[model samples]
Target: GAGVSQSPSNKVTEKGKDVELRCDPISGHTALYWYRQSLGQGLEFLIYFQGNSAPDKSGLPSDRFSAERTGGSVSTLTIQRTQQEDSAVYLCASSLAMVTDTQYFGPGTRLTVL
Candidate 1:
């Protein structure tokens, strides 16, 4: 019955530090996505996980970013060597099945790399 949720809603870290943002998707959802909303920018797709298949990571900006979905329910986005340019709101969404399906979003984790 719970909706998608992200932890440490606001994170402020120094440049070059590593940060891990967590997301818990709603139960029974088969598709999960990670998006980044930068200042004055649109939501940028980061990664997607559907069922047991390998994750789609083409949208990731660089090798500094990575993510994983455990048991098809929870996910974590890790940013290594955080940079000022990486500051943004990391949003997580889950859909019933396909990529075309409607997705429910979390409040997002606002990451500020100082």
Candidate 2:
């Protein structure tokens, strides 16, 4: 079975640019999450999507951050205007629909804005 995956394991972009990070969750998993971890900082929840319910955007840092899940599977996170403060490791994880269930994470897309 294919595990979760993310693209551009590392990305370097200039401030104010837009970057699209991709995530592929594990097969059959219906719950997906997007999180950001600043350098030497803890994980910060960004968004969460489950099958059919409205997506939870409360955790999103700002209006520039947005994500969407398609067909209850793959998801993409778009940072409309990348900022220096946005430089961090963007991690995506998937779980088996149990809040207490441990989530499986991807290698992560490290974004570095200059």
Candidate 3:
């Protein structure tokens, strides 16, 4: 199967606007994750989904950030009321399971909030 795919590879928006980033994980992958990376920084975990269990969203920076996965395959990350500090790349990754598996990442969605 194909690797994860994300839509709107690049986005530029004004402060306080909303943006939706979509991701399509590889088939049969039960674990999915969302991460954010700022300039010259490491990947910051945002949210994670595994199988039918409750998603671990502890990494979300604020209440305005949220994500959901459908059928354990496609996922979407939504950022409400974007801010300048939110300018960074949003990455999506997936694996067969949560532990002892390699996560394959997609080409990140570069978001620039002005």
Candidate 4:
């Protein structure tokens, strides 16, 4: 089956602009996650969605960042008022379950906010 995939492989936008990054997780997988890797920094957890349960958004960096998983499948991460610091590789991953499960990662969407 297909693995996790993110859209727009690369995005360039002016500061303060809004950008929407998409992710599609593998079928039958009930766990999805979003992460960001900034230059010279470790991967940062952004959010997680499991089945129909409430999403864990504690990892979101700021109110400017938000996401939603629909039909327990596709997900969209929306960043409002993008900032220069937001430039990074946004990664998506999926697993059969959480925590102990093995996660499959996407190629990631590279976002550049100028």
Candidate 5:
């Protein structure tokens, strides 16, 4: 892809339902990341994957959140039993190498729980 593409730009669901957000990163990118942004909060790092290294999953808030990258390309984020507090925009970013340059972000998937 030319840029990071996030699916379901907007989603509305009842609390406790599982939701999966997809991200298609730019071609030839070696670093991929997931982030969260609440109503008024700054971007929060969720996870990062670079090359074949161990993924950095330190930012996931709870056990209900999980993500994975396949073939070092596309990635998916799955939230299980979503909560009201989980309502926010899920952003995915990619770079030729996050360790060296800046990241390019996607439009983001907006998830709303009621």
Candidate 6:
């Protein structure tokens, strides 16, 4: 099947606005993850969903950041009241299962909050 895909590869928004990023994981994949990467920084884990289990959201930077996976396939990451510091590339990855599997990443959505 195809690899993960994300919509709106690039987004530029004013500070205080909100943005929603979408991801489509590979068919049959049961694990999904969202990460953020700022310039010169490593990828920061944001949220994760595995099968029917509760999502692990401890990595979310703030309450304004949230994500959900519907039908165990597609995922959306929403950032509320965006700030300049929120500027970064949002990456999505998925694997067949949660343990010891290679995660394939999407191209990433580059967000620039002005």
In order of appearance, the predictions have TM-scores of 0.97, 0.96, 0.97, 0.97, 0.96, 0.98
Model 2: which residue pairs collide?
none
Note the residue pairs that clash in candidate 6: none
Tens digit of lDDT per residue, candidate 4, span 43-108? 999999999999999999999999999898999999999999999999999999898999999999
Please report how far candidate 3 places residue 74 from its true position, in Å.
0.6
**Per-residue lDDT over 1-114 for candidate 6, one digit per residue giving the tens place of the 0 to 100 score:** 478999899999999999999999999999999999999999999999999999999999999999999999999999999999999999999999987999999999999999
Question: lDDT for each of the candidates?
Answer: 0.95, 0.92, 0.94, 0.96, 0.94, 0.96
Between prediction 1 and prediction 5, which has the larger lDDT? 1
Instruction: Rank all candidate structures by their lDDT, best first, as comma-separated numbers.
Output: 6, 4, 1, 3, 5, 2
Task: Candidate 3: give the clashing pairs.
Answer: none
lDDT per residue (tens digit) for residues 1-114 in model 3:
578999899999999999999999999999999999999999999999999999999999999999988877899999999999999999999999988899999999999999
**lDDT digits (tens) for residues 1-114 of candidate 2:** 478999979999999999999999989888999999998999999999987789999999899999988888889999988889999999999998849878999999999999
Candidate 5: which stretches are off by over 4 Å?
none
Better of 3 and 5 by lDDT: 3
Model 5: per-residue Cα lDDT over 14-111, one tens digit each: 99999999999999888999999999999999999997778899999999999999889989999999999999999999999877778999999999
Give the worst 10-residue stretch by lDDT in candidate 6.
1-10
Question: Model 4, 51: alpha-carbon shift in Å?
Answer: 0.6
lDDT of 1: 0.95
Q: What's the number of clashes in each of the models?
A: 0, 0, 0, 0, 0, 0
lDDT of 2: 0.92
lDDT of 1 by residue, 1-114 (tens): 589999979999999999999999889998999999999999999999999999999999999999999888899999999999999999999999975799999999999999
> Local error of candidate 1 at 75, Å?
0.2
Better of 2 and 4 by TM-score: 4
Better of 3 and 5 by TM-score: 3
Task: Itemize residue pairs with steric clashes in candidate 1.
Answer: none
